[model samples]
Target chain A: MKIAIVGAGALGLYYGAMLQRAGNDVRFLLRRDYQAIRKDGLSVTSPNGDFHLQAVQCALDPAELGPVDLVLVGLKTFANHRLIELVAPLMQDDTCVLTLQNGLGNEELLAKTFGAERVLGGIAFLCSNRGEPGTVHHMGQGRIRLGELSGGFSERATALARMFNQAQVPCEAVDDLRRARWEKLVWNIPFNGLSALTGKNVTELLRHEPSRREIIAIMGEVIAAGNAQDLNTPIEAEIFIEKMISATETMDGYRPSMMIDRLEGHPLELEAIYGVPLTRATACGVEMVRVRMLHALLELGERN
Target chain B: MKIAIVGAGALGLYYGAMLQRAGNDVRFLLRRDYQAIRKDGLSVTSPNGDFHLQAVQCALDPAELGPVDLVLVGLKTFANHRLIELVAPLMQDDTCVLTLQNGLGNEELLAKTFGAERVLGGIAFLCSNRGEPGTVHHMGQGRIRLGELSGGFSERATALARMFNQAQVPCEAVDDLRRARWEKLVWNIPFNGLSALTGKNVTELLRHEPSRREIIAIMGEVIAAGNAQDLNTPIEAEIFIEKMISATETMDGYRPSMMIDRLEGHPLELEAIYGVPLTRATACGVEMVRVRMLHALLELGERN
Candidate 1:
């Protein structure tokens, strides 16, 4: 596959590097990492294994790397305004655009601009961060749930998932993409919002009973909202929440990406992660009060 | 009236000085202000009028103050652990113990220990803070809604109101004390908790529409919880919330006492302000979900 990575942050660099190593034609349209990547190439530090691609296929301008078979978007939702402009030059006639961004509305935005049939939605469970320029640190978990944006199984989705899996990444093709998105949101809305707002890590939040209870309550709200979104299988609030809590506990002292973003003065993925989901839930007549409170607080914090 | 002021913080100092200037014998059982007050009397800077007592009656020990007709408790709710021990030595056979502490359960605790008949509850709208060691800054409002803890108006409550009114402090006797407490909480639980938790003042919070909406929602929850307490008059949520918001807006850049407490590394009145109210609401089958979220966050912030 002749693939193009549009947002060459950690996610883009790491995934593109893997695909490139698998002998697929992968090129990254880079920004801060452009000069360094062209010189020293791309370096990925992973617990799974570390590797350096000495001859990284990189470009500063998207037009220079024009017309790929696939366009993988990893742009921070805060910069969604610049997304279409960046991706336009990377599109071919039959190109598929897959967005592995956090939360909702990414696929819809892309589809609205580039047609619904050409878009794919993927929920990525990747714990990664950027190291020095041209270096991507994959701390843990690199799984992708790839699916058709319009829902149901498709050969294209399956082929895409298989490609990622064969490239040494955990990937699965899901029948219901929206369900997967909402499930991830059930975990994201509370943990990310709380950690970012309070600057408390996972362990510290769970250590306090009241906050822990609130975490569970918010998770339940997200689940309720998710269920109301016409999912194939409604999330079992009790089981899923417990699993998320226990999984978070095992992660040791972990701060979510949103927390890191806030600390580092990067714009948050609030619109994608919070704003979009809130609108969707309310549209479906579901009231997620606690989540709304968290969203409002996070918004207020961002203002400060 | 022979009155002894236990918990001689700013509230106690200002009120005690007012009563003393009214020709009543007022003695304060002091702590940090002991040396300064004893050496140079007490200073009160008020918008009403500034005053300095040349011979302020104060003692380090409650035992030295002896039993008095009235024992005014202006202690922070966090110090309720030491409340009984400190107030015991100063209580007389017919001493009316009036606690002007923030939040619920103060009257109940006093009533449980010192007999219900001897307990009076006063919700003072006093905006005062400690200046120098011997000085109290009466910045804004100083009005007391005095009432018997057991409910309904009484001669003692009226006489106490009359005394405070005669002392140049605005005071009114109320029929239902719990109603007044809850009414104050409808304002306190939101502003106090938000200001303390986020370190945002009233103006900043209200300036943001979402947080302002949340503040109103929490106020409604509190009003519901208050109405559930079988009050003589239920708080009208819409009117009360609007009034509270407008009143808060006029305060310019007002930081609540809890926010100041959190910033100064002082223990918050969490138990009295949140814990007690949450318990009461739950018992009454009125769920204050947003308030609980606020409470939980504040508790977690306190832990940090």
Candidate 2:
């Protein structure tokens, strides 16, 4: 399959490299890493295995990349303002757009612009960062769950999942994309928001008794809100919270992507993550009090 | 009456200066301002009036200050570990201690150390900060409500209130000290915690709709917890919240002491303001969820 990767941040670069190594044609639409990768190839330093793709396809503009079988979007949600302009050039009649972006609204935006039939949304559980120009570091997990934007599993999604699994990237196709999205937020809303707001990583937050309790309470609010959204399976609050907390225990000293953005003076992806979800949950008659409080605080912190 | 001021921060210095100006013999136990105050005087710049106490009494040690008729404590609660030792020498069988501290535990601790009958708890609604060495800037608001820690009105408390009023500091003798303290927290728990965590002041927090809603919610939690504490009268959430918000609106860009402490890298008075109150609320079977959340975030922010 010929895949065009848009917004080639660490996420885009790592996944694109993985797919390319599995005998799939991958073209990356790049900006910062364009010159370096075009000159010396793309380097991926992963715990799984490090690889260098010498003479990999690198495009400065999506127009240069043109049409492809799939357009994999790893764009930072804060830059969604420029998403359509950058992505329009890569769309063809039969081409599908799969956005593995963090939080809500990404798939909806893509679907509205390029038709719902051609949009698939997924959430990535990858711990990765960009190294020196042309290099990507995959610290850990890279599992992905994707489904049609209209909801429910599809043959195309299955095929896509199989392709990713074959390429050494764990992938699954889900019947209800919304449920998967909410599940991802169960971890994102608390860990990302608190870590970014407090400048404390996962371990430090959990280590503090007060913060750990707040994290758990926020998780309960999220679960309640999500369960109210007509989810196929209501998240069991106690079990899910413990699972998320225990999983985070192993990620000691690990800061979420939101934390990095805050520390690096980048705009937080607030609207998609907090705003849209809060709105959605409220529409379902569930008030995510703690989540709303965290959102308000994060917004205030970003104000000046 | 001979009075000794312990923990001469902005609060101690300004109030101590007022009492001394009103013809009471006020001696300040000092650290940072000892030399400047002892050599020159204590300067207070207030909106109502500016005054300087020439040849004011300032002591570097409680032993030097000696036993007094009244011991006024405005100590930062984070330094409570040294409190017992510092205030020990300034005590006599007849000397009574009035703690005009920000939060809950001061009176209890003092009572436990010195006798329940010798302790009176009060909450100050003061807007002041220390300026250059001997100068204390009294920006606005200096109202104090005090009562016996044992609850109900007493002749001593009434006389103390009269003394403060005679010194030009607006004063009230409340029958229920716990009620007044909790009512003050209706403002403090939200404004202080949010401002300290987000680096936004009162005006900025109120102007933002989300944070404003959050502020109101936390106030509601505080009032509920307070009402459950067997107080004289239950706080009407709507009236009290609006009243607090309107009053804060006048303060404009005021940053609470907690915010300043966070910015200056000083230890926060978290124990008196958040810790003791939270414990008390939980004991009353009232879970102050939002207050707890804010406290946790603030604690986490101060972790580093």
What is the TM-score of candidate 1?
A: 0.97
Report the TM-score measured on chain A for model 1. 0.98
lDDT of 2 by residue, A108-176 (tens): 898888999999999999999999999999999999999998988799999999999999999999989
Docking class of 1: medium
Model 2 alpha-carbon drift over 4 Å, by segment: none
Candidate 1's displacement at residue A110, Å, is 0.7
The models' CA-based lDDT, in order, is: 0.91, 0.92
Candidate 1: chain B TM-score equals: 0.98
Candidate 1 lDDT over A176-291, as tens digits, reads 99999998998899889999988898889999999999999988888888999898988888999889988888878888999999999888999999999999999999889998
Model 2 reproduced share of reference interface contacts: 0.91
Q: Across residues B199-227, which tens digit of lDDT does each residue of candidate 1 receive?
A: 89999999999999899899999999999
RMSD (Cα, Å) of model 2: 1.6
Where is the poorest 10-residue window by lDDT in model 1 chain A? Answer: A295-304
Instruction: State how far residue A140 of model 2 sits from its true place (Å).
Output: 1.4
Q: What stretches of model 1 exceed 4 Å from their correct place? A: none
